[model samples]
Every structure is written in C-alpha cells, then in structure tokens.
Target: MEAVNLNKKECKFVVAVDESEESMYALSWCLGNLISQNTTNNLVLLYVKPPPPVYSSFHAAGYVFSSDVIRALEKYGSDLVKSVMGRAEAICGKFSSNIHVERIVGSGDAKDVICHIVDKIKADTLVMGSHGYGFFKRALLGSVSDHCAKHVKCPVVIVKHPEKR
Candidate 1:
C-alpha cells in the first residue's frame, strides 16, 4: 500500500456524490471515519451530469422543440447539482466544519468522468458508495464504482450502507 502524505496540510480527497442515499452514506462515512473532524483538508465533492439531450432530425419536420425546453432541462440539471451538493454540505457541517469542501460538476459517463477528474486533480483518494446490487442486477446495469476502482490510479474506497431493520 502507498503511504499517504500526512504531512501535507491540505491533501485532496474526492468523494463522488449523487442524490442516492448510498452516496450520502458514503459522504457521511468519509467525513466521520476517514477525515479528522478538527483538521482542515481539501474535500472535493464530484457530481457527473448526463450529456445534453440530442435533438433528432425528425423533430424539425413538424415543429421544432422550443429553446424553452432546452433551457428547462438545463435548469433542472443545475437544480439537481445544487440539491445534491447542499445535502453533502449539510452532512459535512453536521460532522465538522474544518473540512474545506469543493464542488466539481462534470459532464459525460459517470465512470469515465470520475476517473478523469481523479487523475486530473491528482487526488489522494476517491470515495464512493456501493449500491449493493446483486450479481444479475450489477451485470445488467453495470457498476460505476467497480469501473472507477479499476481505472483510478489513487486508492478507491467503496462504502456500503448498513442494512436497515
């Protein structure tokens, strides 16, 4: 295992977050377990947005999709980013205020974008949540954390939420 740079004042730690409860669990776990509540560190929260909607040629035949529709979609995407980031910030605030949180929004496939950002930022670690999907479901839907773990050069931690009663 590679030794972490404990001497660095602000080692960057990236956490992939979304609206899912699993992601929220991962964020909370990272704050409480991996990071010190009293020390200041660079905490990056990453969110990947889906690619913009592509309009088909068929739509131009009868009537064009108004720019309003596109704007609305963009607005919804922005709102989603804000909502998820807000929740993450709240979690951090509850745990500790010493962490300096940075929000990063990327566009593209989740797996690819996450790997790219982790490399680009030279982050110390990448933390993500596991959906805990069964084999068949994972095989069908694919697992973002699985793909990221293989591609990211830094250490990847996949946090699994405890089962509810």
Candidate 2:
C-alpha cells in the first residue's frame, strides 16, 4: 500500500448523482479515470431530491393529501437516496479502497444544491454525468452540468457514455 500524506488534508471530490444511469456512469468514470491512489481523497456522493411535495390550501373538491401518503412519499425518497448511494459505494469499492466515501442528501434544485455543496465542501473537483441532451432539449431544460461548469470554482468534469456500437 502506498503511504498517504499524513500532513495534507484529504482532497475533496464531489460527484453529483441521480437515479439516471448517466449519473451512475459518471460516478464509475470518476472512480476509474480521475482519482489516483497516491493521495487521500474524500469521495462525496451527493443526491439532490426535489423538495417534498407541497400541500396547498386549495385542492380539487377540497380534498387534501393524507399524512400517511405524504409520509410514504418521503420514505420513498429516502429509500431512493440510500439505494443510489449503495450502488455508488459498490462501484467505488470495485475500483479502489484508498479513498474515504461520504454520502450527502440534499433537497432542492439539483443545479443549485450541487453548486452550493461543492462550494461548501471546498471540493477540488466536481464530477457529473451528461444526459447528452441535444441543443434544443438543453435549451428547453437547462443542463445542470453546463450550469455547474460555468458557476463552480473548481474544475468540473462531465462524463458521458460512449455510443453503442
């Protein structure tokens, strides 16, 4: 085993993850391609869930969503975060065991939350998967990776899967 830098702080690398396969691919790519075994690194797996559904005063026929239903939804969201993180950790384990892995669950817009967390952690690099949206689609729905690349202070890596043969 290589000797880790005892005096140096762990290099922080944040990977933005979602339910999409693209995001998973990005995590794998980051592990395989970007990280080196020589340094101690903090591999933060970040999942940003949309804010919990809001129950407005006005509903159709004055019907309101039940507390049980809301709780179930929240539970589902939590499960999803755990599931994704588990998959990410499995991938990381396969690639390397030198780095420390951490999971972060945030609620809000993905782009905003990712940028905020990257800044908060003072990450050395931000990695994300590209959905490979075309120009028109990207224009219609702003690309989170593009936004991060523009706004994040640290280096941003957007990994995209190769075309199938």
The most accurate candidate by lDDT is: 1
- lDDT by residue (1-165, candidate 2, tens digit) is 966445664678998877767778888888887677667878999988764433333344767777777677667778878888898888888974588899998877678888999998899899997762221233246788888999999889998866521
Distance from true position, residue 129, model 1, in Å?
0.8
1-165 per-residue lDDT for model 1 (tens digits) = 967666666667899988778788888888877786544678999988765533322243565676777677668778989999899999988974578889999876777888999999999889998762221233246788999999999999999877631
Q: Which ten residues in a row have the lowest lDDT in candidate 2?
A: 132-141
- Quote the lDDT for 89 in model 1: 90
Number of clashing residue pairs in every model?
Answer: 0, 0
Error of 1 at 126 (Å): 0.4
Q: In lDDT terms, how accurate is model 2?
A: 0.77
The reply for model 2, stretches above 4 Å from the true place, is 1-9, 54-63, 132-141, 163-165
What RMSD, rounded to one decimal, does every model reach? 4.6, 6.0
* Model 2 vs. true fold: TM: 0.80
lDDT, residue 25, model 2:
85
